[model samples]
Target: MSDIAKEIENAKRIIAEQKKRIKDAQKEAAKAESKLRDRQNYILGGALVKLAETDERAVRTIETLLKLVDRPSDRKAFEVFSRLPALSLPPQPAPDTGHE
Candidate 1:
């Protein structure tokens, strides 16, 4: 083969190898993303299940306490607790000034 033709053939071979490598890398990336998504979903589902179970237990405990307490005290306790707002993650406050 002429020198120019040999060079052209070598370039084509390099391009083909590069394309194959790129395709393989893309497949591996897709597989890793799918695995990561599955793990995230499983963790989120488990957290939701745990939160529901805890909420149910809290409600049952509160009901039991109301049953055990007399009406007047139970009403008073309920009023006190009701005064508090629903619990939530509040924004973190800035550090306090040391100046008194």
Candidate 2:
């Protein structure tokens, strides 16, 4: 083969490799983003659970905020949760006084 033809083939191969690398990088980036979203959801769920246990009003505020999401699924989830029974914290025992 001619030197020019060999050079062109090499350039093509390089371009193909770069394209493959770019695709792989994009997939990795998507996976990373998905994992980040999952982690954020876990953290949000934990926070909401704690807030619900501590204060029903705060949980209601979060439900109201969820309605602001443009996604229908978010609103639907909030509605479903609204129908569920409210979380009640366990009653705390009264502190004993030194008199007893």
In order of appearance, the predictions have TM-scores of 0.53, 0.61
Q: Model 1: per-residue lDDT, tens digit, 34-85?
A: 9999999979745644554558665454456445555554355454443222
lDDT of 2 at 57: 82
Instruction: List lDDT for all candidates, in order.
Output: 0.64, 0.70
Q: List candidate 1 segments past 4 Å from native.
A: 56-100
Q: Name the regions of candidate 2 deviating beyond 4 angstroms.
A: 65-84, 87-100
lDDT of 2: 0.70
Error of 2 at 77 (Å): 5.9
lDDT (Cα, 0-100) at 6 in candidate 1: 100
* C-alpha RMSD by candidate, in order: 13.9, 14.4
TM-score of 2: 0.61
